[model samples]
Target: MISFEAVAISMQGRTLVRDISLSVMAGEKVVLRGRSGSGKSTLLKAVVGGTPITAGAIRVGSLAVVPENIQRIRQEIAYISQEPGMSRETAAEDLLLPFTFKAHSGKEPTAAQIEAVLDRLLLDPAILRQKSATLSGGEKQRLVIARAILLDKRIFLADEITSALDAESKDAVFSFLLESDHTVLSISHDPEWIGRCSRVFTIENGILREEK
Candidate 1:
């Protein structure tokens, strides 16, 4: 449901991704792998308009990633970065913050729903009471994932989301994503994560190439 047509991304006058084109079908899981600075993350960011592309076009579903439709595009996708940002409020409060917005009004997940999501991610419900600023990196990542789950977006852009998790927690995160119907385009160095994807691509010298 996402397509990048001959896209090029540049920052500070230097091109990070050049002439990259690919398509991800609905319910498909794709992984991008490369060494640091290979533009894997930049390509993911481009899809969500986190980074601007200097050339070509990006489309999510039937909508183009342009200034006018960005907000609408964002509504349909969840972009999770490597270091998910969290507020200083309690974890539960932060998790519920999105519901406070008019875009998500009246869709607040019930307490049981919240608890079930936390349980599915192998996170304790007690974590809800903890200060977000004090949580570890892995906890913060999972919390971000929980927020996305609550948002219930069907497309996910995940960047190294499981890098900080323990094996059990990583598996928990993986299982949840694997079982979901979401279309995922992720950047991961984790072998297990890459292995589960139906398609894999590697960024090399600013170009994207599919790997079997």
Candidate 2:
């Protein structure tokens, strides 16, 4: 489970999230919807330990997202931002980049696994050889998601990943994520995306409010 109690986040002396508490169980999909700059993305970043909390507590499963436990928490969760950073030139290399890290070394997936994930996302196998910079926004989004799937992460924090996807691609991506056993905390404004969530949260003036 993911739990946040009395969580408050302040950056540069300005509070972006104030005393927010939320809980989401495994396999539960939740979306945060609100006007832009309303702290939706900030809350997601806080859960993943990318943003420091000024107060309160955060726990993902039994591991708390404190400075001491950050490494462990990072290993268990996958955070996808709107613009994914790919250091490699080719798509396949980008997908396999994590394995190059010491923690994931020697766990690089087989070619068959990569192909299977791309196929599931409706991406052409030829894209594997394409330059990452040449791909469109929608293609990049799908590729990042495919990489996350190959890593076998149990928790996903998605920030407007489908904003640039077409209807068919969006459906394909959503279908893949929803079918997984992972817990999801997403920041999205798309109506279809919001409708797919099991729970909805809204943020206003740094306060979190459950919509349903």
Candidate 3:
């Protein structure tokens, strides 16, 4: 449900991505793999309008990723970065914060739903009571995923979200996402994550090349 056409991104006069074009269909999972500076993350950010494309176009569903529609477009997409930002509140409060927004009012996840997501991610339900600052890196990552799940956004832009987890936790996170019907475009170096995806693309010198 996402398409990029002849997309190029530059910042501060430095070109980060060039002439990249691709489409991610609904319910399909795609992975982007590359070295540190290869622009995979930048491409993901561009899809969410976090980084503006200097050339060409991007569209989510039927809406173009332009200034006017960006805010609405973002509501349909969950862009999870390598380090998810969290407030100093308890985990439960952080998770519930989104529902307080007018956009998601009355859509708060029930306690059972929250517990179920935590269980699937191998997290303890009690974690909801702990302060976000006290959670470990992996805990924070899983919690971020849980929040996204609660939002029920169908499009996911995940950037190295599994980097901090151990094997079991990593598998748990991967399995949950894989089993879901979300349209995922992710940046990851994890072999298992890449292997489970339906398509893989690698970025080289700012160009996107689909890997066979």
Which model, 2 or 3, shows the larger TM-score? Answer: 2
Which clashing pairs does model 1 show? none
lDDT values, one for every candidate: 0.88, 0.86, 0.87
lDDT of 3 by residue, 100-199 (tens): 8898898787788988888878998988899988887778878888888888778888899878777776777788777789899999998878899999
Tens digits of per-residue lDDT, candidate 2, 12-52, equal 89988888899999999999888898888878888778788
The reply for model 1, stretches above 4 Å from the true place, is none
TM-scores of the models, in the order given: 0.94, 0.95, 0.94
lDDT by residue (117-197, candidate 1, tens digit) is 898889999999999889887788788888888888889898988787777767777887766788999999888899999
Report how far off residue 90 is in candidate 3 (Å): 0.9
Error of 3 at 190 (Å): 1.3
Residue-level lDDT for 166 in candidate 1:
74
Question: Model 1's lDDT to the true fold?
Answer: 0.88
Off by over 4 Å in 3: none
Task: Give the candidate order by descending TM-score.
Answer: 2, 1, 3
